[model samples]
Target: MSELVEHVDERDRVLGVVERGEAERQHWPHRIATTICRDRAGRILVLRRSETHSRFPGYYDVMVGGAVDGGESYEEAAARELSEELGVREPVRFMFKFLCREGTSPVWFGVHEAVVTEPLIPDPGEIAWQGWLTEAELCEVVDQRLFVPGGRKALRRYLESGSGSGAGELGAE
Candidate 1:
């Protein structure tokens, strides 16, 4: 089935809806929900995309996310993606939202957070591997440009949002 994705404007107001594949192929503006999963120890879970996937395959990603389907709110999409991709069913607290464009691709990036309280059974077909890393560890790799473009952008925005304090500092985060 072709997934329907919400297309939004610069202000994040939905302009219309389009097929997910076409949205990607044409770089249409869409809404996506990203969750930065953490555990009690404050380590964040990262996933490596399956090599067979079409976009950024085999790249590391600190955010587990996906398109906001037509008729779905960002919160709904966020929770759904966490369960589908990482087997997380805990309550997720929304952190913030922003609109960004990289080259032609654009997204209303909704950032969320949650302390993962259950075992994550990643779908092998979508995730090649998964690991937990500290903010410092993630920052090191992100500085090296070792993450998917969206992940890098999202993480940078997250760090900036806290002004490198609060939850932004790596080792102390």
Candidate 2:
């Protein structure tokens, strides 16, 4: 069976649940929970997506995340994605959310953050290359590499809002 996602409206109201593939194929808005993992020294965790992955294959991403499962809250999904993708089980702090409509489809994206104190055991199916980059290095790579679009936008927003110094405001679409 395919994964399920919570279909949401523009205002982020849950309408119903749908297969993740169908939701994307039909351009239905859904929630994606992304966690920006940071090391104790404050460097961001970055990874290259697996080439065979469904979305944004082989692209570099500064965050690790996925679709929000049906009936799951953003925080729940954030923690789940962190553990699933990076093999870390750290507590995630709610950051901010925004409507991202610039990529494959529109998605209500919830951004979270966690300080990873444990070594990562990245999922091979989801991550190809992984590393920790300082904020300055991240800025350089974001411009130098073919980064994931939604993640790029989120990174921009994240930086503009003081690079996770505080809870960011509800961002514009």
Clashes (N, CA, C under 3 Å) per candidate? 0, 0
Worst lDDT 10-window in candidate 1: 164-173
Residue 148 error for model 1, in Å? Answer: 1.2
Clashing pairs in 2: none
For candidate 1, the per-residue lDDT at 90 reads 75
lDDT of 1 at 157: 71
Candidate 1 residue runs with Cα over 4 Å from true position:
163-173
lDDT (Cα, tens digit) per residue for candidate 1, span 1-173 = 89899877788888888997787778778998989888888787888899986667888888888889898888889999999988779787788887767623888889888789799899887899998987777777765655776677777777767723335543321
Task: Kindly list the per-residue Cα lDDT of model 2 for residues 15-108, writing each as its tens digit.
Answer: 9999988888899999999998899898888899999988989999988899999989999999999998888899998889999887788998
- What value of lDDT does candidate 1 attain over all alpha carbons? 0.79
Cα deviation at 163, candidate 1, in Å, is 9.8
lDDT of 2 at 170: 24
| Candidate 1 root-mean-square deviation in Å | 3.1
